[model samples]
Target: MSTQVFYFVATLSILFSLMVIFAKNPIHSVLYLILTFFTFTVHYVLLNAQFLAVVNFIVYMGAIMVLFLFVLMLLNLNKDTEPSKSPLIKIVGVIAGGCLIVTLIGSLKAASISSPLILKNPGLGLVENLGKELFGPFLLPFELSSLLLLAAMVGAVLLSKRDEVEA
Candidate 1:
């Protein structure tokens, strides 16, 4: 990828990430996170990882963000009720997040580059290959993961309902 395009994507990613954290409303925060996920998807595409880009869009932007919005709406939270963080806590959070970012960048920079990565013949059919892999090899894991997600959703609903009752 060209440096200009890379810088643009990185800038957009940073901007959206900031918006996600700084947005006053919960719904707006979720929307900003969706934009951030899309920017990340674009970054993945620029790196030639088309499958990852699409998956990022489908999983994060589509499914997870929808879930976030649904929960936010169901709870009826607004800016008025949102808790304000203390300056000390905000500073600690920023410091912790910056440390994580530095570690990730360092590890990525230290990763070794290997040549001749693609040794297989180019395949023509994507859907067929994806379906075969998902159903044949990954079927059980896929189903189990969905079941886990369902359980988590039900648990969240129950927990939130209990909180409402207590309040």
Candidate 2:
């Protein structure tokens, strides 16, 4: 029963993700992305990671999707404004996509599962366990990511700053 449901949701996730890429309208693409993120939240829940599920819902579905929608709206993309693609470009794109698919299939075939995944700690997804793990062995990487985020924030602010024109 659980396996069936997992596969069903996984199928939905894949469908929605493809929709995100193929949708003509940016807003529709963002909507599909949100649906994909929702499916990911369901996946986390199914895996019994309640905290991860909640965080995925809040961060990806809520914050990230909202940001994507906001950016799309502000850009006000229109098909009329978009330049037409050349037949040569289309052929190149198709060739590139086929190559990518072949690479992915080759990688998957070569990386056959060696062992079934076994959960070492069922409660690892809990906030307490997550905090301990992050602050313990993962502390350096964690702080480095925070620092990277801080640098990005500063860069955004600097880029957005208006230069004063002295009269």
Candidate 3:
């Protein structure tokens, strides 16, 4: 099934490439090229190169397409063209805001009713003893979780990164 999907996407990619080359209008050609790039992104996914697929989609489809649109002057950048927010959306926003306020008030009340933190054992609260206990029994899990957190932070950094737009 995977191989079949790959073949199908590959054929679509070739068709899009031909459309990009032979299209009469430049805008149509650029749109077809974007479709071709999208198929390439799918190919990256089929190859199990997740990072490469994400990078290709973000770079080629997102940034490069924006560049193409700007180059072709195909986008309307005027603020006057923007549509006003709908009344239903405004009502939904108000309801969501009210829900958040109620949640916050409930949480604050519950926290005030709760007992304050007080370490029952004096020895266990000490830095030296705490370190001993952590490194003694919980070392593996502690290290593994820290490593996992580090990996997540790195992935977040990579995802949020953007190429600089030069004037």
Candidate 4:
């Protein structure tokens, strides 16, 4: 039962990830990316990492995606504005992607799977356990990451804002 659920979620996640790359419209791509993020959150939930799942949902799907959409809308990107790739270039890209996929599959096939995953401690994924590790030893890095994200958002806003000039 758990394996089936994992496979289903994993399949959907892969499909959504593909859609994010292949969608013609930027908005559609963003939506697919959000779906992919949601699938990742679901994976976290499956792993009993509720805290990580909530953070992934709120930070990635909620805030980052909204920011992405806002930037996309501000840019006013459309099919008409997008440049068309040559057929040869498209073919080359497809070939490259296929080769990459084959390589990834070969690597995975070679990996040893003798031992199944074992959750050392079920409490490891709980929020209380996570908070202790996060706030105690990992505090500086955690705060730094948040600050980095804030800086990126500010940079995006500044870049999108239009400047006005008075004659």
Candidate 5:
């Protein structure tokens, strides 16, 4: 029953992810992405990672996707009105995407994984351990990531804001 549930959620997640990429309208794509995230959260729940699943649903499916939809609505980019690229450019993009997929698949296939990679039973101190590792060992990288995110948010806001002087 657990396996069946896992497979169902995983399949739905993958299908929604594909829809996110292939949807014609940006709003539909964002909605599909939220569905994908929700399905992934279900998969996480099936794996017994309840905290992670809730976090995924809240942070990604709820907050982040909502932000994306808000931006899409603000920009009114439901339809891509930009001029279409040439056939050669389209072909190049397809080739690049194919190469990226092939490379990722090949790397995953060729990677050597060790067995017994997880503890037989982890204690309920998962959050504490994660906090210790994130704040102590990975402090530098964690802080840098926050700074990067801040910079990205500032840059996006600046770029999106209309300039009255330009008008």
Candidate 6:
């Protein structure tokens, strides 16, 4: 039962991920990305990483996706503004994607799983444990990531303001 559920979620995640990339409309792509994130959350839950699932839901689906949609709406993009791809470029892209898929399949087929599908410490996914780990050895990386996000937000705001001024 668990294996079946895992495969189902994995398949859905892959499909949604592909949809995110292939969707012509930016809004539709963002929606597909959100669905992919939801599947990731489900996978986390199935792995018993409840904290990770909640974090994924809140951070990716709730916050990031809303931000993405807001930006898309603000940009007011439409089909008319979208550029058309050349037939040759499209063919090349398809060939590249097919090659990547084949490579992934080949690698997976060659790989071996040495460990059992069980966690050594189930509490590792708990908030307390994660917090301890984060604030301890991973403190610098955590702070750096927050700073990076802050920089990205500032950059977005500056770019938007510049666009407004130009208009």
The top-ranked prediction according to TM-score is 2
TM-score of 5: 0.73
Best by lDDT: 4
Clash pairs, candidate 5, are none
Model 5 stretches astray by more than 4 angstroms: 78-82, 104-116, 120-125, 154-167
Q: Across residues 1-116, which tens digit of lDDT does each residue of candidate 5 receive?
A: 98788888888988998998998888899999888888888887766667777888889978888899999888887345756789999999999999999999999999887674
* Pairs clashing within candidate 6: none
All models: lDDT? Answer: 0.83, 0.91, 0.83, 0.94, 0.83, 0.93
Tens-place lDDT per residue, model 4, 1-167, is 87899999999999999999899899999999999999999999999999999999999999999999999999989999988899999999999999999999999999986787787888788999999989999999999999999999999998888876621
Clashing pairs in 1: none
The residue-level lDDT of candidate 3 at 52 comes to 64
**Residue range 26-131, candidate 1, lDDT tens digits:** 7888998989999898887776657767888999988989999999999999767778889999999999999999999999999888664562533312456656
TM-scores for every predicted model: 0.57, 0.88, 0.44, 0.75, 0.73, 0.74
Error of 1 at 57 (Å): 3.8
Q: What's the C-alpha lDDT at position 112 in model 2?
A: 67
- In what order do the candidates fall by TM-score, top score first? 2, 4, 6, 5, 1, 3
Task: Name the 10 consecutive residues with the lowest summed lDDT in model 1.
Answer: 119-128
Kindly report which residue stretches of model 3 are placed more than 4 angstroms away from their true locations once superposed.
74-167
- Which regions of candidate 6 deviate over 4 angstroms? 22-24, 91-95, 154-167
How well is each residue in 20-138 modelled by candidate 2, as lDDT tens digits? 89999878988998999999999988888888999999999889889888988888988987789999999999999999999999999899668867899978888899899999999
Segments in model 2 whose C-alpha atoms lie over 4 Å from true places: 86-92
Superposition-based RMSD of candidate 6 using all C-alpha atoms, in angstroms = 3.4
RMSD of every prediction = 5.0, 2.2, 24.0, 3.5, 3.5, 3.4
